[model samples]
Target: MTDTKQEADFLIHPENTFLYIWQLFMVALVLFSAISLPLYAVFAKDIPVLLIIIVFLFFCDIFINLRVAVKTKNGFCWETAEILKSYRKGFFIPDMIAALPWWLPVALLFKNEEPGIITRFLFLLPLIKILKIGHYLQVFEKSLTINPTIIRLIKFIVLVGIIAHWLASGWVLIGPVKEGLPADDFSKYIRALYWCITTIATVGYGDISPDLSQNHQIIYTMFSMILGVGIYGYVIGNVASLLANIDVAKANFMRRMEEINSFIKNKKIPLEIAQKILDYYNYLWETQQGGNDSQVMNELPQSLSIEVSMYLNKTIIQKVPFFTKMNEVFIREIIMQLEPLIFLPQDYIVRRGEFGDCMFFLSAGSVDVKGSNGELYATLGEGAFFGEMSLIRGEKRNAYIMAREYCDVYRLTKESFDELRRKYPDFDQQVIETVAERDAMNKKKTEKPAAPVKKQ
Candidate 1:
């Protein structure tokens, strides 16, 4: 079992770089044991160096499991006694015996004589490590940022590859080992692999058909064919599911677009207006990925939501001269109530003569300060605040505030701002000081004479 204990309590963090590296090393050792053990047991000759490593890792794994944090039914078991108890109750014995290099001992014991089927089964004992792969995958799933669906798909492929490798190894020891085998182990393994793939994928080709005369060989071939059919069906279903869910955001976006189109068609809306709506939706999909940011924040606990909202609007607050001098508590209280609004290109957030109950703070993209005849006075980018003077004084807007591009603007309602300001006496003085200068600047800009027309 992979332990994902609390970070403070962990002996080794699952996300630690060293832990992942160690896991990769262990997986490599398992693969080596899985392949070499069965193949070497047939000859029972010289001992390989990997057998030494496996024996060493077998002991190391015991200590690693005992110390590493383990999660349990209640939660992560941080107590040392409980950790040991969990390990003892889990795969400790089977993993211990399976991880042992039993084939090494058998090879040495029967050095002069070749081993039989019963003795060869000692090499296969290590196959249980293959089962513990599920445990290792849990660690990877936590540490790696890759999509789980992608991981599962890759895992399935690797699993099939390992199964084929195992079957190929066994195929070599099926009958008279020398009858139709290649000159070398590599070539022999390759031939066995080819037969396994062809046999399992489809009924084997005539060129590599199994001998019908041997009862065991026929039975083995039949099982492989049956297993192949099951594998084929399972892979197709799972792979299809994975591919469909790979782009969930896109899927949701399309569904929303379809519903919008249906409404547009039913209402007999003009093509130009419909196109603009579609463009607005496209911008929403790109920026928010077909989801409501407010709803997402609302789903989080109030404490977390407050921190996240404040963090996102932190820069905007710092940029506001009125807010910069205010205490963090006042800033945070106001920021939490700010609602996000997106404006598409050329869309007027507030027209030159429209009354508004809210002000906007630009968080991303840019907007234009325009007047009659679409005269652009200024292009405000991120951290720019506008529409406040109108809200504070309860007067009509002096100039058009239009989005120059897709803009993410956070709106603070007059009611919310008033509520927060009421609790702080200094807030009124700061607002009065800032809006006076802003009012003078706007009056000058809006009063400017019209541009000269070129004489033709």
Candidate 2:
């Protein structure tokens, strides 16, 4: 039953699932509809079924946009007045305009005659519908989970296609290829496309050269050459940068480890100690993504890192009684002061009677608390914290704590605690209240009668 409930919960991620479905649907709709427009124009008589399917898909796209606006916040406004306001000045206004072309054809249905000049021009609505690609690009950029490099690459590809289509349209409209060709409109566009690709790639094949005798054709050709150089350079630079980003951190870490290994050998360090060092390095590399946490944090702006840290540590820190009532800023400060730690199985984290200077927040795994005689007192798991009593009161640890398994924890030292208390008077009061409660609990435990031991 528990497994079933867990599975149900896993299936209940609402926003992310909706966004994923939305992205896929939009990509398919745009690609299919966009490609269909040119083909429909070329072979209008041959593929009546394809034209109907394209028309149906266009209407589906309009409804899809309406649904998106209704379901997604800041999509299209839900209120009538707000929807009008958004139509005037919102990100979705272009999408609304793109749908207008579909309605024009519908309006012509009332005339019941050969299409008018307006209706014929309305066939060009597919050009306006291309705006949806830009809308999707904006959406993809805002997504946190998607890689920015991939998003940039997608944008580049789409831009190149759009540019190529525009150039081909210009070429066909200017009559550079001549009207008497036996080939159809599709064949003409294909020839224009071939010229555009060669020009943009700077691979002037000379077989399909543009008609440079005409001034417009010469200007167009020159523009294509310049644009091609810029696009080619942009793609090369971005791909190189992305590859460098992928390799730099990993390569640097490997090189540093090699140097460390060579030093260990030169110093004749004990094999057991060297192995432990290597294990520690490996654990850090795996967990920290091959960089020092402090150094990484240092690179980010203080406010940005604080927000990120607060997001990660807020839930765990809230389990600490003293932090329960603290404000976000206070909690963020505490998170910034915390240091990460990892403990191996059976490792003694805190020994009984030792002066404790820090408290631990167990982020993962389990630990056992034992009394002075090594009898188990209690076991604590993830989100559980301990050592606060000693850290708060400047006293010796009352019990020994050891990791029952490999554990990850965050430690907050007394110095940071003291600084916080000094900065925030409210923190001092919370600390005092927590200390009193701990003292009272300890007194009750000391007063209780000892349990009788069972005979073996």
Per-candidate TM-scores read 0.85, 0.57
- In model 1, residue pairs whose N, Cα or C atoms come closer than 3 Å (at least 3 residues apart or on different chains), thus clashing, are none
lDDT of 2 at 349: 92
The lDDT of each candidate is 0.79, 0.72
On lDDT, the candidate that comes out on top is 1
RMSD of 2: 9.7
Candidate 2 wrong stretches, greater than 4 Å: 1-24, 46-78, 91-97, 100-122, 161-195, 210-223, 246-282, 290-348, 351-353, 357-359, 365-406, 412-456
lDDT, candidate 2, at 71: 31
Over the stretch 319-363, how does candidate 1's per-residue lDDT look in tens digits? 877888998888878888888888888888889877878999999
Q: Mind giving the per-residue lDDT tens digits that candidate 2 earns over 1-456?
A: 253652443321223566566666766766766655544443343324544554556566554443332234633233434434443564354455454545344444745554443443444565455666666656656666665665666666777887777667556555366556657777888888888888888898977765767887788888989998998898787867775555566778898899989989999999988987787778778777687766777899998889878877799999989989889889888899999888977789999988989999998889999999999999999889998878987899989999997788999999998899999999899989988887899899889687999999
